[model samples]
Target chain A: MKKINLVLFFLAALVAFVVNAQPPRPAPTPNDTLNSTKVLKDGRVMFSIYAPKASQVTLSGDFLKEYKPIQLVKNDIGVWSYTSDAVTPDVYSYDFVVDGVKTLDPKNVLLKEGENGYSNYFEVSGPESAYASIQNVPHGNLQKVWFFSKVTGKMTRFHVYTPPGYEKMKGKLPVLYLQHGGGDNDASWSTVGRANFIMDNLYAARKAVPMIVVMPMGHPGAGFFMNPGIDEDPYYKQMFDEIMPLVAEKFRALTDRYHTAYAGLSMGGLQAMNMALFSPQRFGYVLPLSTGYFPPQIKLLEEKYADALRNPEINKLKLFWICMGGQKDIAYQNGLNCNALFDKFGIKYEKANYDAGHTFITWRHNLEEFAPKLFK
Target chain B: MKKINLVLFFLAALVAFVVNAQPPRPAPTPNDTLNSTKVLKDGRVMFSIYAPKASQVTLSGDFLKEYKPIQLVKNDIGVWSYTSDAVTPDVYSYDFVVDGVKTLDPKNVLLKEGENGYSNYFEVSGPESAYASIQNVPHGNLQKVWFFSKVTGKMTRFHVYTPPGYEKMKGKLPVLYLQHGGGDNDASWSTVGRANFIMDNLYAARKAVPMIVVMPMGHPGAGFFMNPGIDEDPYYKQMFDEIMPLVAEKFRALTDRYHTAYAGLSMGGLQAMNMALFSPQRFGYVLPLSTGYFPPQIKLLEEKYADALRNPEINKLKLFWICMGGQKDIAYQNGLNCNALFDKFGIKYEKANYDAGHTFITWRHNLEEFAPKLFK
Candidate 1:
């Protein structure tokens, strides 16, 4: 009788367990992930920019038809996105023509230099990719890029132009981080100015001193640094985070005030000045061609740069080349004021003036003239 | 009865003569009509390269995206022609990206200064639908151009940049006819160079002397009178027969030398020298930005310019400004040689050697500087 009662109790417990087993956890859903990581069988990369307000969104670039718009599809995030099929491996230029305005993709991390402003760059996974391996050119291997930054949301893109035979070469080449202005990305100097050809020609002719050039994009209205007024433009965030990490990761750049350097034109010039004054420990040389540094917020730029101006280490700057074209009256006048301030601050600097105004001619000439002065 | 029979026979013979009247000249077929008045409708423009035995041909320009392998359709005239409706309205800079290499169009009579050689230009029709109509702004007017030419096959392209208050206000504006180098159309100056903006800004700032500027594109590849390498390039015959005569008929231009003018850079400079020397009565002022009238075949340039070179009617010539940049070794050397030759020849010429190269900066500056000197 006692065994039978115990068996009855066990049976009741088993019955309850069977009735109350929690519903199997729901399988993972695509909507559950915020940042979608999708890999296609063919290997195309995809991302979406959610803008419910944008009536029309088209992806345009070196990838698609020249300036023709690429239409995007809508999703739950109110963001529009599209994925391209596995593209050939090469540096591709692209931009988002949102509505009628040209813009860079907000979601994609890669970017290139604009002819004058900033452009977007894409990397595709494929067997015949030139970008996959450092091209087997007869000379040097491309310096692999890597870095960590606090600015540009973290890892940022940067490239180095190593002199031919830098790998086989015994000595370090002088470094010139040539930057592109706003609306430009990393590839601008090479594409628009044909920097590679220029460098090649100069080196071939033995006219230009051998050097490693670093081209970075300096757009105020980019990523987290976006703003109309200069001081408000938060490129400082990128300067700290993205740019540095990549610089450190890529080429074996010299780590001295004089050995390390920065130079840019227009927005690029402003970037050079910001890098020069804000981080005296990192750079000794600064050539601002047709540009000057202002706190992205003018008031703040002046105030902060003022503090930098008074710093003792600032005087250690090897070269503060503030150059502009005579025709660029606005920039020239502004640059003149900056040069006068540099003089007042006793900053060792040189000012070179070209006959023309805010133009690439002046910038190219400035590079040719000023680059040779570094690490000499 | 005899009289009636004779009369009937006479009527019958006359009727037969009238009925058998020589078949009315076969109504000219529509195809022949179209060939005569080619409207360029299907919206496609033809780029013809007359290479008798070339295996392949292609057309390239800023118009074609990437200048892809545009296959050329052949003609019985041994002309390799390619048609395109792919370009947009505006001055597009391009070249014939022929088989594995780049070449200029053999048919289009337009050119511009490029990296090593001149680039080609093609114009897409504007919105006005009157082919191309000048847009009249508060400060200036872009005129509709039509001209009869003897240089390129038949009708040629030309545009005039006129300053504000010209139609209503009756003062002769010093005319400055700026020509593209070679391979570019008249629209090149307007599109890529933004000639209108340059003038508007200069004039608005009261920096430039207000004047009517004309851009005409017509140059043969042969001699002082034609192409420098006439035999080497096949387009020489087409250019001489078509492009020039049309420009002279299109716009209202000043007839006097002082009121009229001429200037260009590179091949354009060659054209400017050729035009002023060959057609001396048309241009009082000549500014060859970066050119030398010396192509072994330019005996005509020498012959025509010989009188102007010695005891030059300096006062009548207005201003013969010839200048280049200091760094353009080739151009500077050529310019310097010309200066010396001109000096030996007792030619009173105005010249400048700026600290730059034979690039657009120097050329732009040359144009900017020369404009103020015209009819001033």
Candidate 2:
């Protein structure tokens, strides 16, 4: 018995030695470092990049504001990292310039198409970010719908945001026809503006009524809205004829003008104004955020229907809200000129202003304020 | 009169000279060279990266095959450009190694998240790439749907692809519960696999029936399906209970098992196998592409359902399809082992093998072959 026990003990010791000596599970590669854009508990962000051979890497972003690009310090493991100063609570675009080559954050998956190229974006959460942040509230569902457009003679796509329990809801819900800015498509509102999250948070707080928001592609063809003929605009004709009918049939949406609202930003805002002016009885509320009537548009509106602005039918509108960023915005003067024209025509309208330039931040705040006052 | 004519001529010349000498439009900046990953007409790709200060730049991609990284020549404008050999028609992921740091193509908006990191992707169109290529056929719509999952206790998202005219279709449509690989989410099928294009092409050619493809988030909680107990898997329970019911109610999906098919790749394939075994009558067709049973998984299945393999329910499955790449694939042996086990149990299954290794190319071919055989 002693001899057998001795042999077993030696065998077990050899097996244990082999298991323990099996080369430290291979050291982690440089990519193993999960040091990417991490939001700190204090609301500051920590950005990191693993570039072992890079001589220099600097971080630049709109969140830096007027400040210069922040330089990162390299650690012994060749991962450069930088903890930002407490940033304001909002979504911000950022990029890294590695040895004069401007590139996006490798670790950040969320990207937005900017004037230049695609930039990585992150949301810094705080009290002010509640509207855009993912809260404990019940969330809505977004559907990407593709429909054939007779006006454009091509298949077009749009995004629809249905509120929580929309499927099982008892009756038809009111609709908000939202549109995106100049260079953006229908996806911009939800992806960049966080429109769904904002609506969910507001509905959870009882600050906004439950409604379906439809974001259609504003620029169907080339050349923005510079296409000379108003009737020939593909998106405009499609919205009324094809899009609205499809939305009503496919979704449980209220078709009455009293249950309808229209809002947009920049070029989309211009389109919204045109849509409302062309069909005044289609929408009860018209909101043009961060955009207003230019000289040519105002002249055309005056030429077409000067009495509509002064008549009781216009007064029958639930709300005519206009909002823009601060005076620094390029469109601020246009907003003021349009307001003056409304004043001259004795048209009652509500106005709101924010202290920021023309950006998604301004548009999001505008939506938060504008949505609450709609369909009352 | 001669003197006045001379003066006018001089004025005209001066104005023309001023217009011509407009400072050469200030030299193009690095960002102005929007020339990264351009596909030439002859099926070759031209890759350019703006790394003015970098010492070295090279293009690396699967398209290069066994060749070394293609060295890029820098032009006087500080942009590095390289024209690759005529590549075979397929979508390829690539990255630029600038000064030894691997980075994605900054100008390419299309990206795919691999096991390593995010990589830029470009399509090479040709006859062989028909299933993945965008043809003139009527396209389907992709919807991103979010629903609450009681198993995970979180709002999980999935992507649904509805074929052309699905909205106006008269009857319930068959559903394919497609799942992505380990590192990918619900969007992988549409974005990376080009599943929508594949279905559109197949349907246009009358090679496949019209159906809805639903891709759910397979990895519900933490880890990559390695959380020990298989019965306690969050995604497995969610798919049968919450996901199926929600999809059935929201979309026009046929709830019968005869119309239902299950398919996935790699880790997803493992999960599909688990689901089919757990509820043998739930899916009429089972497709495990580029993945199959390993020793441990086979042992677990044997312990749980040794008699199920010999039973008639699994044998009644409409199709038991197994596909993998050539011998070069790491999972080829796994496929063989699983096949041998099936043979021993007298189970019938269809097998397909391609010449390529483990990649999206192999998976795409497998899907093209497998989809036509489903819901027959």
Candidate 3:
């Protein structure tokens, strides 16, 4: 009877070993445990960094006035964290200055390349910033297309966004020629502006028509749009002649002007104005966000295209929408001055005003408000 | 006469000031001045970090045998730099431990996400590492595609690479189903492996056929490929049923076994073996790099598909290539054992060996050698 009890005990121990032999759970990674940047529900942002040995850490960004650097306090676990006041809905770029060395937030992956260096960015969004937020809706496809640019004498790339159901549903889709700001390329609109998500949510709510959006690089060479001798007109010509034709041929894009629109932000805004004023018959709708023509540029446009602006056949524009941020915006006075000039030329236009100033939020709002009003 | 002379002197001074008024040159950023990592022409790598404040710095990486850390010396410019002895052609991940705190290369952007943290990676290339090097050729387009996976029940994303001239080309292209190793997503193969550039150069030299490469996530949920509950068969099924069908429908792809190939590295290699054995009819060519079936796995495969392996009609494989590093590799013995099993079963296969041990260079060399033999 004792021998039988010993055998049963050994069997029970074996079962316990087998049960405990399951794979061990993986330890949480630093990215999983650390909250480097968190967007609170109240539109405030909390930034943290792991620097146990460092004596001091500070945060600096363009969103702050005069680019002031804010100090952070250390916690029990050796993490330095700082919470900012309730900031408005906008994408902000920042970096951690640890012991006087500018260090990127190791926890944050969303980075933007700037003139000086790369800056980590986070978005503070609420109902007011709904257009840029991800919603429960069918998303569109963002494609990278590479083509030879005759003007640039090199291979260039552009991003094309085909609306949801574009593959299964076969129909000619209208195209929107979207452009990015200075120092950015074709990827800006979809990546930074969240244009595809914005369009997806708009389409889900039936607020906007489903159309293909084409974002092309505004600057093909190493120069800004406002710089002299950049000669953006030739690049624009190349777009209409080569790039647009290729886009239409490869994708299911309509070739007619009535099914085409042009929109851009900042330097892209300037390019859009140039395209509209010069090649008025190429696009039916035009929207220039957060950019306006100065007096010299307006004079140049009037002198160059007096007959086209006066001719109803060539100036058959369906919508000329101009959008800008509030009075605090650097371009606000310029926008007003340009509007007065447009009135003097008897050019009909629509305008939009947002509370934000010269930020992606303002441009996103412009896209949200303008995209729905197009192709009507 | 004195007043006139004074006015002339003042005019000369004003001219000098105007000449100097041209905008001052901006200071160089860390990326411009420091060479955090540089691959010498002779295959040696030099790494530098600008940490003047730190008392000590060391370099640690998988390339180092015994996983030892090497100390770095500080230069006059307050930059800590280290040059390693002639390393072989491969990609390596490393970090600088500055004053006992781990830090990434601020200048280097090519980073690999590991289980614990992100590591900065550098590639060493020469004539031998031709496939991984960026040769002057027409590059392919790397696209990010988002699709819903019914198996995972989430919106999964994958990257697709189309060879140059895919848009303009007028024929159905072959496809290569590529997979990443454990702990890596679909972006790993393209971003880290430089697969697109490899294909571009290969196609330019007419060594390899132009094909569409689809890289999909190996693990669907929160587990590694080797874990028990992470049954990769369903994920492979999803790839064949949904992802491949989508690729075929959207892109110009040939939908036959003769036009399809399969290859993967590490855990992905294990997956490739499983898929090729189970779904032999789906792929004509199979190459498992730096991974192979162990004795137990081979036994299981033989047991499950004894009749299928013996049947010539069902086992009509064009190529069964297995590749791994030298004897130092952890998987080298398993690969040999698997080959012996194949020999016993009268299965024909090709094998290649490299000098390295279970590194990306070994897998890259495998791809370089194997891709040329596919779809010929």
Candidate 4:
């Protein structure tokens, strides 16, 4: 009876792999995960597997497809081989769907721990990739920004890019407290703006002066669990009372107005004016790119900087740069109006108009040009 | 029957829009389609309907579940209105879900253009914006690279930028051939890479030398339907023979070999070498950022430039600049190998090691630096 059962099991195994009178597939061994990275002659990705009995084997993930992958040809050495062309610029999930069950490639190196079994992930290259900027120049480290706001309680984010030689220097670097527009947090400049890349290139080229950049989230309570009241609350007051102290404590930062700067785009641009005029003590360089002073804020501007608008110390700033998009209407005639007001008050400010609409391209370039001129 | 229907709707509307009433909704209006432009004022959006006798009317879209929306109140003008705090940027499809039946907003400018009906879009001041450099720079123009490639046997895409006063010149401007990386067409640099913006900024700041930049499709047969042969296709040959002549003919360009420049990254960088060295008479300046000479092409290189690799003309043709990524192993080492060879051969060249992985940020910055140096 035992012999008969063994024969029956052998026949079943034969039926599983011997579909077209071909030799039976070899049984998979525990260490079949041995064959690893292989680069094809044409730079294609090649890898080996030991799925001896997988009738339908495919590499499905971010780079490849799911479940049913292209068959990997089995070579004489009992290993299955597959090669793939490179794909897009992000991490993708893939699994070796053997017959029916899903499984990750046992050979890949980069993996993020997750709940429902560890899924396989691969990194595809970016054509004009932001992540690749680290190799071209010395990138500023990204340290987390935490601050307690009186208006929204605790927990805020600011990303700082300190100039090179910052850690060892005795004298503090000048600070540029930059803010992002709406919808974006502290991450916008790094991701889409490629701010680090721009700064790295500028600093390397010696065309721009090096300065510390502080990018803070415009919205407060952004990561709040139950209720994120960031957009609803006006945290301009919080900027003065809360964020400044937190940043100063963390980095080798300049303290007084002479060495401090304020800048932002769109909503953040509106905030730049707010920082310079409202606090009046924290910043020396003021730049509002793409958006300008609001109609309601016109009255307050006179009251806040009545004596200093013309003096290089007041709103004139070290570099009171105001700019707007030629196509954008939100800050449309707003720039013209701001320039007119500055003219009226003898504010002695500088303003430029760009031809395109309001976008990260313009804002970053504005800084790429403006930063070198500041604190010079 | 119509009178009875109107009476029923009005009766339902009173209960629906009492302001803070239970089960609040807006009444249905005569028109269809949401006019977001008008409602976008007050930095807020409002729900409205004209249901004369409805108890309640509501607004709902993909953002909501089961069509539960904030209610509306009946104004003196008979329009039911409910003011909402500004929503973020995205497309939304809302329906009245009136008395149980679903209906869309009639007054929005954003249309349901897709096959799916009832789609409305709005841009509520997001940080992601258009390029401002294109509009601000006076000497630059964003023109399309239109060419019928004899190799690809199809019309390919490219972008051409000429510095200010480019057209006024009696003599032709110096030409620089620039290429984008894989998976990206000519448009990638102009749009995502913001190449035009970078150039615009450089020109605006007067930091870059003004010249004409010609960007071509990086891949073979990208716009065409058929593959134009791989290694020995007559198509690539014709690109040098036919297409180059056509582009030179259409644009007022410097035609001599020393007057032309070539630059690209990765696959593009490889192509730059293929064009300049393989078809030696076509170009002068060669800049391959983060790319090595075609590895396997050493065989072809031996056959073609074997004797001349040691010659001065190989270097003296103009400029030969190469860049490499620090973290990149396969490609980085390959580029270094070629740089070493260039040194051994006494070729005049410049090599910079960028602290980047394979990325767009590296190439974009490289271009920002290189474009200004070309034709100087």
1 against 2, candidate with superior lDDT: 2
DockQ values per model: 0.00, 0.18, 0.13, 0.01
Question: For residues B111-177, could you state the per-residue lDDT of candidate 4 as single tens digits?
Answer: 2211112223333433222222233234344454334455656544456666655545567777887
lDDT of 2 by residue, A1-376 (tens): 1111121233333334544654323245575556588888887888988877677888866555442478889899778889887777987666787766667666666766432246667888788887888776777778777665667767667889989878568888999999887756687788777899899889998999899999988877655572212475677778888889988977789999999999988777777666555666788998887777666667766777686566666656788888887874556776887788878888777888875666677888888888898787
lDDT (10s digit) by residue, model 2, range B14-116? 3345447433122347756567878898878889988777778887665765424678999987789898888888887677877656676767777664433
Model 4 spans with C-alpha error above 4 angstroms: A1-135, A168-170, A221-234, A296-316, B1-376
Compared with the true structure, all predictions reach lDDT values of: 0.51, 0.73, 0.70, 0.54
| TM-scores of chain A in all candidate models | 0.56, 0.80, 0.81, 0.59
lDDT of 1 at A266: 66
Ranking by TM-score: 2, 3, 4, 1
| Local accuracy of candidate 3 as per-residue lDDT tens digits, A272-330 | 77666667778899988877765555666567756655656434789888888777555
Put the candidates in DockQ order, highest first: 2, 3, 4, 1
**CAPRI-style docking class of model 2 based on DockQ:** incorrect
Clashes of each: 67, 0, 0, 47
- Candidate 4 vs. truth: CA RMSD? 24.8
Which candidate achieves the best DockQ against the true structure?
2
